[model samples]
Target: MTGVNFQFTRGKRNKANRTRSPATERVLTQLKMISQRRKQPKLLQVCQEDHIRHETITTAFKLYRQEINANRAKLLLKQYESIKYAMEDLEQINSYLFHEANTNQKGKRFDLEMRIPTEYPPNQIWLHDYTPAEVAEKK
Candidate 1:
């Protein structure tokens, strides 16, 4: 028996794809503000070993960002290689079609709607399959 990769999901996902954006900047800015305020009197003295903790946090954030960058790069590279291989196969089958595809796909931006599934796959994986107009017409 094959293992089931099934899970329930609601497909109304947002296009919140981050492109070269660092979460660390916002956090560091707040940290900087806190540090600046340290000069004045404070209500609570919770920040013990402030410099060391700051360094650790900064380092961890940088490392995490690098890891995310590397993973993204790897996924992109895999996608690129797959596309290249597909083009090669298409060229082998039909050169004209391959040329048309290669030439026409010049200024196409990557669609953010096609997201990598983190948990379970989206309920409506492909938008092209279901048409409300068709359903209306049928009824």
Candidate 2:
């Protein structure tokens, strides 16, 4: 009623319990064997339940990996589209600049110094207390 409230309410979230990579899991699966020392063997129902749980975990990981891949593909597609549109707009605006941009460079490589943009703004906006080198340059 008075001011804005910023409160976070805890809620139950479905999270996986796996701590290992799927490849590692698969490799470990090959090394496992059913218990041989049988005073009493495990029940059929228990075995089935364990199998189901394994399948569920495998399915969940596969789904999660697929989701991640799809997101990456979507981001790449968006960037491609933006470039395509910008190029088209440039062509319409001026042919010379567009052709200059469209020139093929077979040996072009990505700049090592370029930084990828992040989802959130950085902690420091600009270097306000920065100073340039006072050393004089020889002609």
Candidate 3:
């Protein structure tokens, strides 16, 4: 017969269902019992299964490293912003103090040092850009 026209025929099969070996059946029965009793499988229980422990450990390590790097990035950004604000304040003070000076008859010049009070008395900081009371009430 040509390859295209060839047909396969079935032979007589074994009458018995190929039974699982006794040890395999016992293990399967134990697994079923454990699964029935426990709602959640413990990580240690799953790790005992072959080849899964390495994958789980590696994934956990990577997640922890990512969290550490993210926290470090946030801390560095906060430090940068703090330094930037301090520099801005220093620039403002320098401009106010040294931009103009007065010369006396002996040509001795004195640049006035404008003192920004170190103490923040109550309500010293400007409070602008707050949402209007009426708008806040509507929200």
Give the winner by TM-score.
Answer: 2
lDDT of each: 0.74, 0.75, 0.65
Model 2 spans > 4 angstroms off: 1-46, 108-139
Task: Write the residue-wise lDDT of candidate 2 on 11-88 in tens digits.
Answer: 642235455568977777676644334478665665878999989999999999999999999999999999999999
lDDT at 13 for candidate 2?
A: 26
Which sections of candidate 3 miss by over 4 Å? 1-48, 95-139
- Using TM-score as the yardstick, the better of models 1 and 2 is 2
lDDT value, residue 22 of candidate 2 = 83
| Local accuracy of candidate 3 as per-residue lDDT tens digits, 69-108 | 9999999999999977876776677855333322234533
In model 3, the worst 10-residue window by lDDT is 96-105
Candidate 1 Cα outliers beyond 4 Å, as residue runs: 1-48, 105-139
**Who is ahead in TM-score, 2 or 3?**
2
Model 1 scores a C-alpha lDDT of: 0.74
Q: What is the Å distance of residue 22 in model 2 from its true position?
A: 44
Tens-place lDDT digits, model 1, residues 1-139: 4775544555653345322236855687688888784367656555669867988999999999999999999999999999999999999999999888868655465555657768887787667854454365688
Error of 2 at 78 (Å): 1.3
